[model samples]
Every structure is written in structure tokens, then in C-alpha cells.
Target: MTLIAERVRELTGARQPFVHATVVRAQAPTSAMPGDDAVILADGSIEGFVGGVCAETSVRAAALDTLRDGNTMLLRVLPDGAASFPDAPGAQVVVNPCLSGGAIEIFLRPMLPRPLIGVAGATTPIGAAVVTLAGFLDLEITEPMAYAGASAVVVAGLGRDDEQVIRAALDAGVPLISLVASRTRGAAVLDSLGLTAEERARVRPHAGIDIGARTHQEIALSVLAEIVRELRASSPEPVAAAPTRTAIDPICGMTVVIGEGTPHAVVDGVEHWFCCAGCRDRFVAAS
Candidate 1:
């Protein structure tokens, strides 16, 4: 258990998504005892043992589901004949015939990485202020070149080399690019870069929420606020209803457009869709 805990900490530090499955309860004939734990990696590999093969299978399936949707779940694995036992509210129930009449309840918790913001061109006071404000806002910050993995990049170069910094950030494929500069200067920089209209549109000039900021700190706060808004907009919202034109893949949690050739399955009277045939096969096998 201590080793598993240490591994979990290591994985968390690496910003890798994983599921920690802990056996909260166990009935007689179960191979595992309460308090046993396992770490399920994003690739569906199990590093520790929570139960025997049957129970572990269910745990892996539930852990994958939790990792895909970023949801914590209480998974109850019972023998096929034990279906009469009432499952706890909000618990995911899996009936496995190979459980040998034993039952196990495991809690699956998904650990996802925090959103990262790259602060580039920090040589200027404005850039430094943005970094400081980002820290205060509990946002993780990285160098400009390291922004490739970041959720967004804020370029605060308010000098001659501002265009260079912005170009580097854009080439890194950073989703959101916020440039701190006057409208005239930003337009001049964009024109000089010879970027396409679409690429130019990606740059947010004056890079902040419209709070009429004047000082560096205020500007930094506004920029952080805008970043927060972008993050919120990118996050997956609850689906009020399953659209006929699109469906979420159960295996990988990817939103798939439903079309003539799209992969799909009907499991237990519920329609499940997949982005690819591989995901569809995996979902069928798991089910």
C-alpha cells in the first residue's frame, strides 16, 4: 500500500492521468480485503492488485470510465446471482460470473493534470507581473518554448522583440495566444509577420479582459481573467440530451459525430457510440 501511494504521488507530480482504485468493502470468499488498492494507468494497465481476475477486470473497466470522464465512482462488483442486492446510490454496478459469489466495492478516483499557462517574454515588467499574478491565481506557469504543452500562452513582450516572441508561441501550437501590446503595434507586428488571416485571428491583441486596466498589475489580472474564461469555455459541459448528430465515446470519452459510417453499439438498451472502430471494439469487449 505504501509503495502504491508513493507511485500515485510520482504519477501526480508527472501530471499524468490515472485512477486510484481502493477496495472499500469486501465480502466473504473475496480474494481481496478491505483497504487493498491498485493504480490503473491511462493505458488500462494495473500496477497493483485490488482483487482477483474477475474483480480486477471490473475495476479496470470502471477505472477507464472514470479516467475518460474525470468522474469519481463507487464500483460494486458482484457475482451474477447477487444481482438482487441493492446497489448503493450513485454506485456503478458490474455483475461478473467469475467472482465466485464474492463481492467487492472499489472506489475509483481520477487524478487529472492542472491547466498550464505559459508566460513568455518575461524580461519585461509586464511579463513578470503576469507570471506573479498567474501564481496568485493558482495557475501553473512555464517558459515560452515549453508552452507547447500549455493550455494557453501569454506573450508580454512590449518591445522591439515582441513579434519574435509571439511568433515562437504561435509556432508551438498553443491553443490560446494573448499578446500584450497597443492595437497599432499589434497590427504592425502581425502585418510584418505575413501570417494568414486565420493565424492573425488567433492572436488576441491587448490580451486582457476589458476592465480598463492601466498599471502592469491590473493588466496582469485582466489577462488572467481572460485565461480563466478561455479555460472554462474549453471544458466539457454537461450534455442536456444526447444529440442525434453527435455522441460521446464510452471507451475514450471523445465526442464523435454520428454519421452513416460511424461506429456504435447498443449495450443493455443504451446506445453507445465511438470515435473509432478500435474504441468500439474495446467497449464491446469490456461490456
Candidate 2:
């Protein structure tokens, strides 16, 4: 496999979110050629070369934007005063004053991990139905032991260890906690757990939206629909912790995402972040 492909596999195995940036068009005098690629990790580190430091800076910022919106973007990086063609939706134009003279267009695609769901009673009909139906919807069905990492946890045992699983999900801070039970039984079970009012509110006792579901399969459909609703509301998993933040480069006036790998220099007890080391050096020299 290609090195970029291998890195993608490794990240996928680790369930780490990242953006794959590929240069689809490179104008004259550009350092990056068409097909040059790079992997932008969640931490804003670039794994490969798409362009020089200036172009990479713009790509890094745009890549992070794509990660936030869960959209693939075609980023057009042009030199100062260079007019770009009109862009369609999911396309952006960035003017980099530090560019040598040519324009570069890179495709930034965010690779997000599948939303994981934990079912408490995998062998039971309701739980098994969740697993089976999740397969069709491309959701990851994880074991109860891995509930801590799940986007949502469903206690489908119908009273079997319902309190234990519910408590575990609550403690884990899973985004969606559901119990597959009738209204009365679910309420009694939740009350018996002695959870706080807010904690009890977090658990969806009926588990699914009221869809007049009667059979096991129908009920499972409703429950999965509810899970899908929550997923849509949150816009997928692994997007929970990363917040988009950027600062303008003092010298070049380029916007740079504030990350561990970004170049920065402190002057007069005030720290300033830069898009590239060259800009940082210029700022330091002027300071």
C-alpha cells in the first residue's frame, strides 16, 4: 500500500479523526504537483507534503474547517492580488501573501470514525436486533465492556441488569443513554437506581420514539431511528472535543489554527502565533 494509504489505515484502526488533503491542481511556479497529498491529524500536524510552508499553513486552516463542518472542501490558495474563479459550495478561496507566485488547489476530506453504539444484552432479541440493524446503517456495535467509548449505550435487557448498565452509561457520560422497557417498568427501574433528577432525565426510558411499534424488529427500528436522530443532532462522533480556533499571523497576516505544531513566538510577554516559521522569524527579527 502507499504510505498515505497506510497512514490512513493506521489512523482508522486507532479510530483517530483526520483530514486527507490532496492537491488536485497546481498552477505554474507552484512547488506542489497534482496528486501531492498530506494527512492532517486532529492535532493540526501535517504528515506529508502538499506544498511549501505558506501553502501548508492555509491548507491546515482549511482542513480544520472541513473537520468541524464534516464537509469535503476544495481549497484554492492563491497569491496576493490573484483573482480566483467563482467557487461552488464546499469550496473556499484563500489568499496567501507568502506564496511564491502560483496557486494550489487541495481537496480536504475529513475522515471521521463511525459512531459506536453499545448494546447491553447482545444475545437478547432487542439487543441483537440493534446489532443487526446497526450493521445495515454503518454504525459500529460495540460490546458492553467498551461502553465507555460508545456514543450511546442501550440497556436492552428489559430489566436484566438494567440499573447496572444505566449507571455505567451515566458515569461514562455517554451522549445518549436509553433503556428498552415499557414506561412503567422503565420508570421504576430508573427510580430504583437513585439517580439525580438531571441524571434520570438523561436516560430515555422508552428508548425509541413513539412509532406504534409492536414487534421486536419494529421496536428496534424505532430505537435505531432515535439513535440516528441523536447522531444527526450532534453531527457524528469524535467531533465532540475538537474546537476550531485560529489566530492571525502577525507578520504575514495569514490565519493559523492554534495547535501544538503551529509556529509561535513570544515578544513583550505577549505570545503571537504564526502560520509558518519564516513569518515567526521575521516577527522575531522585527521585535
Candidate 3:
């Protein structure tokens, strides 16, 4: 596999969010060619090259935006005063004064991890049903040992180790904790756990939407539906994303993402960011 492909695989395995940028169109004088691709990481670092620094600046900014909204975007980077292509709705256009004399178009696609869930008793009928249904819905399954990164945890062991899994889920701060038991048994088990009121409230005792489900399959379906509802009601982002800092390059007039990898300089105790070393050098020279 190519480096970018391997990197994508690694990121996916690690559950890291990133943007895949592919050069779709290139004009004369542009260094990047069609089919060239790069991976823009969460920290605004580019693993591969799609264009020169000016074009990269635009791509990075747009890539971060796509990561935030979980949307795909077509980015058009053209030199100042260059006539643009036929306007495409939802496409972002950026003019880079530092571009030598060409334009490049890149497609940015965000790759986010699937929501993971933990199941206590995978061998039981209801637990197995939940796993199968969750797999069909593309939700990843985890064990109690991996609950730290789980979005939800369901104890379908029917009192067998249910308390242990539920307690672990609560301790992990999982968003959703479910116990597959009747109201009376569930309440008793919860009360015996010696948990705080808030912690007990976090668990949904008769776990499942009130659909009068009798069979294991029906109960599993209801439980999955409840989990989906809870997930949708919470924040769309899997985690709270750190805010991005950006600045305009004084010489090139291009917006640059401010990060450890970005070129920057300090003048008169004021820090100024630049798209590339050349822009930073020019700014320092003029100052």
C-alpha cells in the first residue's frame, strides 16, 4: 500500500480523526498534479504534499473546516485576480497572492471513527443479538477492558456480572450505561452497588425503549434504538475538539493555521505567522 493509504489505516485503527485531500484539478504553473493526495491530521500537519505552500495553506484551513463539520468540500486555490472556474455550490474558493501563477483544486474528505459500544455478555442470546445488530449498523463492539473509549455500555448478562460491567462503564464516564433487567431487579442491583444518585441516574435500568419487547431479538432491537436516540441527543462530535488558531500572513495575505508545524516569526515582541519560510523571510526583511 502507498504511504498515504498505510497512514490512513493507522489513523483509523487508532481512532484518530483526519482529512484526506486529493488533488482533482491542476492548472499551468501549479506544482501539484491530479491524483496527488495527502493526509491532513487533526493537529493541522500534512503527511503528503498536494501543492506549494500557498495552496497548502488554503487546503489546511479548508480541511480543518471539513473535520469540524464532518463534510466533504472541494477547495479551489487560485492566484489573486485569476478567473475562477464555473461556480460550484458548496465549493470553497481561496485566492493566494503568494502563488507563483497557477491554480489547484483539491477534494477534502473527513474520516471519522465509528461509535464504539461495550457488551457485557457476548455469549448470551440478547447480548449476541445486540452485537449482531450493532455490527449491521456499523457500530464497533468492545469488551469491558476497553470501556474507556466506548460510547455506550450495555449489560445484557441478565444479572450475571451485570453489576461489574455497569460499574466499570460508570467509572469510565461512558455516555450511555444500560442494564437489561426488569424494573425491580434492576433497581435492586443498582441500589446494592452503593453508587451516588447521579451515577445511578446515569444508567438506564430497564434498558430499551418501552416497546413491550418479549423475545431476546426484540429486546435487543429496542435497546439499540434507545442507544441511537441517546447518541443523537448528545453532541454530534465524538469528543470535544480543541479550538484552532489561525492568522493571516502579512506578506501573502493568506490565512495560515497556527500550529507547531507552521512557520512563524516574532517582531517587536509581536508574533506573526506566515504560510511558508519565504513569506516569513520577506516579512522579517521589510520589518
**Poorest 10 consecutive residues by lDDT, candidate 1:** 237-246
Q: Kindly indicate the candidate among 1 and 2 with the higher TM-score.
A: 2
In model 3, what lDDT does residue 259 have? 84
Q: Is candidate 1 or candidate 3 better by TM-score?
A: 3
CA displacement after TM-score superposition, residue 44 of candidate 2 (Å): 1.5
Error (Å) of candidate 2 at residue 263 is 4.8
TM-score of each: 0.73, 0.84, 0.93
Model 2: residue 89 alpha-carbon error in angstroms: 5.0
Compare the candidates by TM-score and give the number of the best one.
3
Cα displacement (Å) at residue 203, model 1? 1.1
Off by over 4 Å in 2: 83-90, 234-252, 258-287
RMSD of 2: 3.1
Tens-place lDDT per residue, model 2, 142-230, is 76757777888888887788888888888887878889998899889978988888888778988998899988888889999998998
> Measured by TM-score, how close is model 2 to the native structure?
0.84
Worst 10 residues of 3 by lDDT: 234-243
lDDT of 1 by residue, 187-266 (tens): 77788889877778778876889898989889988988998998888775211222235566676554455545567899
Full candidate order by TM-score, most accurate first: 3, 2, 1
